[model samples]
Target chain A: MSSAVEEKRKHQKAQKKADRDAALAKKAELNMTSLMDIFVNVLIYLLMNYSTSPVDVPQSKEHTLPQSSTKLEVKHTTTIAVTKKIIMVNRKKVCDVVKNTVDPSLKKDKQASSYLITPLFKELKEDVQKQKKIAKYNPSAAFKGEVTIVADQDMSFRLLSEVMYTAGQAEFSKFKFAVVKKGG
Target chain B: MGKKIRQEDATEEINIMPLMNIIMLLIPFLIMSTEFIKIGVINVAAPKIGGGASSSEPKKKDEKPPLNLTVSITEKGLTILTRGKKIPEGCDLKGEATEAKLPTVKKIGDKHNLPVLKQCLQTIKEVFPDERRIIIMAEPEIRYSIIIDVMDHSREGKTADKDMFPEVVLSAGVL
Candidate 1:
């Protein structure tokens, strides 16, 4: 009779332990606060490291760049185009008032277009300053306030050197020279 | 109230100690293995005047004679000048008796051939084994790769010889 009574007591204790484990498992399944905290932290990391551009180039027919294999699709806020015979500062053909290509001998001949580089240089300087102003308003903006030059492959080094000198005079130290891969 | 108390006791706090330990170990490992690029260079000296061109001064009979090798690259072909004269015929591109040169037709790898410029450097390597220094005045319009190839051929087979390594100085001028 005593043995039977002890067995009944052990069976009741085991049933209570099984009920406690099932209730704990159900509580864990419903508690989503910890998982939500982990997800929020991951989302924050992704947003902070994302490469977002503040100034994107608007679609325009005037800015058709020559295709190049080495050309990186850069989101430049300030762009300058130095064509075969003309210099385009901020999409305006300021180098040549007319549609004539830049003639290298014009500098030697003392043409009016050669001296117009001073105003072009001033415009480039102002564009860089404006980029900095826009970036200042937003801390997340990665604008370096630099200008990208798109030059023709056949352009003489002497002409290219002049552009470099003007950019240097305007205090724009960062430059990326675009070139197509050889044999491309 | 009883159920809420049980839930609080069952869950433990998230541990960040192991993550921090791994990051600390990784930072030091990266710092230790970082490598910087190294550039190689060599110092050079010009040879002294001897029994060659400036013969106006008196000569020393007991001194060792200096070897004079002339390496020229013309529009026509290469010309090797030794002892102040051209080598024998059949070596020049035009087969002229006045010009000492190699067959301007040798290929670089079946694609690029040694132009008159490269042939001049190679001929200099063969004739005067000791005269390893050369001055090349090339045309401005010649491709930069052609100039580099001439310098490369200057010390071709004997690059590791240390003594025969040629020192070729290049300059650009109007042809």
Candidate 2:
């Protein structure tokens, strides 16, 4: 019994020594400012490179796009104009007039009733052929790239059908109907 | 004194964890905004300049060389032009005798006469059977419905049979 009491006294004395050492270690400080500085530098670098470029949106004074609720911004290399009487594909006029010379005896306005679209098809065919000549990044699928159509709001379905049909024939399946952004 | 010197050395070493975090966020931003490739287009036309430039002017044949056709629709009616020349083949009859000769029917449909347009196309095709296909030009003022009517009839013959589809190709042209 006497020996146990002596051992307990010795353990208590060691505990007091450990407490003093711990108090001295607490006086030593860990600096956090350097770690904070590194974090701020990294954050600034990230923010600088965040948003790179603006969306490409082409507009013209001659044509006003129809109103639509779509959010997609078109990125077309070629801009097609749908005018009051002419369809300009990449600034080239393909069909100038619709006429019928045969059977002048039929009527004075027989030619006007008939619509012709041969030149536009030829132009589209040419475009497709030219793209195939370039090296690298060939689109094997149909409706590739930005094809913006500035179709007039009043154009007849008959005429529009021909336009859509022609575009489809040219392998231009993807289409963006140009429209003014609401409230902009 | 040796222990104090060792502690100072530990404080001098830089922490790199924050620098690594910033790089991760920046990479996604650059990739999302980038447009790497653009599709190229080429315009094709009939070869105009041949070597030695065939200077000889060929005699005018009775048949006219193929001319581009343009059709414009307005509130008034459809206007037709061929190479800027006026052509009137599918209009209403003028004389009273022609009106009287028309077949009497209970209904005169509002639907545009497709046959009239087809007949006009037929004549154009006959003149240039090998090259009858044409690009259709119309004004935006024209109705979408009317334009479809015109194209449906632009073919020289019956469109019911796919085999007999008139080879007319449609195109849009600026006024």
Candidate 3:
């Protein structure tokens, strides 16, 4: 009986050792090479398309852009965004839009069917002057009189015209209307 | 001696823990920085003030008038007019006249009949292949988004695989 009990203990010990070895082998079996390859490819792709330019306009829920089939790429310029409630120049609110028209109080200079809004004109003028000053100092950077308008689809032409006219009066002759690129 | 030789020949495992941590951090950073919505631009020249004529010389009586194509958008639909004369039976401008007596276009599929409007514009484009400018006259109540869509349609004719009217002049519709 004593010899039999000793044999049983030895068998249990061997079984436990085998189980532990199997667990360890399983733990060491992970192939990180494939995972590392996938990560490297993803990183390469992301790095290639990474935009370093700081002039990208932040899209928001209120400022959904109209879709277009045009192939023209957007360039860095002063952006004026018109939403349902407000008109913003470079993300700063210049005036409020109500009932498809800019608030009368915001228009300091009132004329019949006036295209220029006072607050917007002042903001765009400052931007143009600052750009001109920068171009004067930096020979490589030239002021191109470019302005980009990113307006909501629900906005009316009256407000757009006023904004464009105001920007034009501010000496921004070249206008670019921002649109969401459609399709591949 | 054989066991010792095998152990010596084993390659050292590289410590990729730091690299893994860096890559994990970089992925989220890149995703957050990436602009998913690709922004495009439609160039527009500021409208010339004072209505200055292109040429200094007086126009000859026999010379054909410039093709001043105007696409007027009202509540009913789109109206294609050339030199102030409406294109007969081409447009489907069908809606109740507004208080201002301006006919508006019916909205088909979240927008005015853009397909029909494109077809109409394409026909006009074939007639005046050389003319590239179109004046988009929209009502004050018309959404700016609709105007842009009309501009896009008028700017290029897809069936022809050519630009119909590249130059767009925005104007408030005749009141």
Best by lDDT: 3
DockQ top scorer = 3
The regions of model 1 sitting more than 4 angstroms off are A1-71, A97-116, A142-145, A179-184, B1-175
Write the residue-wise lDDT of candidate 2 on B1-175 in tens digits: 3645667787785765565565556556655544332211211111111111122345356475656554444343444445655455443222232333322111126444545555655555555456543544544445543543454456325443421223334344433
Q: Is candidate 1 or candidate 3 better by DockQ?
A: 3
Order candidates by DockQ, high to low.
3, 2, 1
lDDT of 3 by residue, A1-184 (tens): 9999999999999999999999999999777777888898898888877765444766676678889888788888899988878898998998888767886656745663666689998998899889989999997888877788888888887777778777777888777889888884
Chain A TM-score of candidate 3 vs. true chain A: 0.79
Error of 1 at A66 (Å): 7.2
Q: Judged by DockQ cut-offs, is candidate 2 incorrect, acceptable, medium or high? A: incorrect
lDDT of 3 by residue, B110-141 (tens): 55888777787777777778888888777778
Candidate 2 off by > 4 Å: A1-62, A97-116, A135-146, B1-175
> What's the interface RMS deviation of candidate 2?
12.9
Model 1, position A28: C-alpha lDDT score = 75
Show pairs that collide, candidate 3.
B74-B104, B75-B104, B75-B105, B76-B103, B76-B104, B76-B105, B77-B104, B77-B105
Give fnat for candidates 1, 2 and onward, in order.
0.00, 0.09, 0.62
Interface RMSD of each: 16.3, 12.9, 3.8
Docking class for candidate 1: incorrect
